[model samples]
Target: MKIAVLGTGGGARSHIAKLLELGHEVAVGTRDPQATLARTEPDMMGNPPFRQFLAEHPGVTLLTFGEAAATADGPVINGIDGHNAVAALTPIAGALADKTLIDYAVPFVYQHDSEHPWPTPWGVMPKLDPCDTDSLGERIQRALPDTKVVKSFVTQEQATVVDPQSVGDGDHTMFVAGDHADAKRRATELLKSYGWRDVLDLGPLVCARGMEMYAHLHSAIGFGLGQQFGGHFGIKVVR
Candidate 1:
């Protein structure tokens, strides 16, 4: 599959690495090519080397976010942080028409020196912003009504997102909610390819409100626990 990951953050890097591990042709879409290259080089320096690394990993490519989104054959995963996701994707909205978009984002507000206490150790949690009333996924869907937007992978930690094996016990489940059946199926397949064992379709784009709330709840749990507990949550399936 040809997948384009949008962003240069940790989530974007994780998606790129995991997609490569799944043997997919992955392209990182970043607004700044030089900056992305610089950021990614640190991990490869003095190992097999950047040039040699590229030779070995020919499937991974980096392109301008717009160009990559315009040319993607399969799903385009939005790994950009919640704050920048809509704007970053705005330019490519037309290109994304009738395409499947895997939205992995959270509407988090970063408040420093404010009266409200931080929700998590990371001082970030999903807070209702002015546009978030309809939920971020729904807002994105509204912006690109033609594009099929499926919300998934928002609750899990980046570490657990890539390696569910590290979570231990049985397995962790990620939630999927979207209005399009075909898009949900595609998102599920992509998640499975990245080694996600359990995926629950919560139904429709509106369910994104609850999904985002779950992310907030997870953050609250981490805050109460006084640590970054990203992979500590799981689902109980009862017959």
Candidate 2:
């Protein structure tokens, strides 16, 4: 199976590494491949440069966003940052048409003004735009009418998402929501391949509202647990 992961951030790296280990041909998408490769410094999240990651994991091809999306025969994981996702993906909708696009983006407006801003240990918490009325998943689905969009993997860290067994012995649950049953099934199958045993289908892309909104709670839980940044944790939908 050929897969395209559209981002070079830490979260994207987790999926890229896991997919490669599963013997899938992985093509990574970036805004500027040459600029990404030219970077020698670590990113804000302290992730090493993409060049180093590519060196360690040979045979992973890096290309422009459109080219990478076109190369994938199977699912295309949209790991692009939440704020810029719609703009970036909208331009490449042609390449993603008729394909199962498993989007896990939260609609976070990193730069915004509010009279009473929510402050976190790091800084002011980013605001969630289109919160109650709409969601990023629905926005993406609306933008790419020809694509099957499934909202998932937003409730937990990507590392914990790929390797669920590390937390609570894989007893926790995962969720997927989309209008297209077949596309949600594809996302579920991929989750199973990642060793997820309990996957709850949260019916319809509108349910993505809850998933994306959970980002704040996820961060709060991490802070409560004394993890200032990038905490390794998972939440279960006990039933």
Candidate 3:
């Protein structure tokens, strides 16, 4: 399988690494390849530069957004910022039509006062845009009517997305939601390939609202548990 992972962030690096480990040929797509390569310093979150990651993984291809999708023979994973996902992928509508888009983006904007810790974050705060009525995943689905948009990885960070087994006993459950059953199943298969032991199908694209909203708690938990744990846990279903 040839996968196109769109973005040049920590998540994109992890996706490329994991998918490659699963024996899938992967191409990382970005809006600005030059600027991405020019980023010599680590990201604010302390993730290494995308260029460095690309060098480390020689098997992965670097590409412009359109080229990545047009050349991909398999699913295109959404690794861009959630809010910017629709805008980024819309231009490649023809390439993505009738294909499954495994979305790992999250629509979050943190707002916090300076009085907090070294890196204060109110944790995504509240945004009506990614709430019950609308969500980043839903918007992408609406943008590409023919594309099957399955929302996954919204509740986890880059590290967690790649290695679910590294967390505790690895019983934590991942989740996905999409209008198309085939797409959801494909998403689940990919998750399983990456060693995600459990995946719950929440059903329908609208259910992404809950997943997107879960970002708040995800952010809170990261800091709450301290850096040692590193936001590496997934939400599990008790029953």
Which regions of candidate 3 deviate over 4 angstroms?
110-128, 228-230
Clashes of each: 0, 0, 0
* Top model number, TM-score: 2
- Top candidate on lDDT is 2
What would the per-residue lDDT of candidate 3 be over residues 1-239, giving only the tens digit for each residue? 99999987777778888888888999889888888889988986688888888888888888888888877777889888866878888988888988899887777544534454334342324343567688889999988998999999878887777798888667888889999998898888888888888888998889999888887677668767774334766667899
**Deviating ranges (above 4 Å) for candidate 1:** 38-58, 112-114, 119-126, 130-132, 224-226, 229-233, 237-239
Against the reference, the lDDT scores of all candidates come to 0.73, 0.93, 0.81
Query: What is the alpha-carbon lDDT of model 1 when measured against the actual structure?
Result: 0.73
Q: Estimate each model's TM-score.
A: 0.83, 0.97, 0.89
Q: Report the Cα lDDT for candidate 3.
A: 0.81
In candidate 3 the C-alpha lDDT for residue 233 amounts to 66
Please provide, for model 1 over 8-58, each residue's C-alpha lDDT reduced to its tens digit, 9 standing for 90 to 100.
565666677777888788877878776545543444112322334445556
Q: List the residue pairs that clash in candidate 1.
A: none
Q: What is the TM-score of candidate 3?
A: 0.89
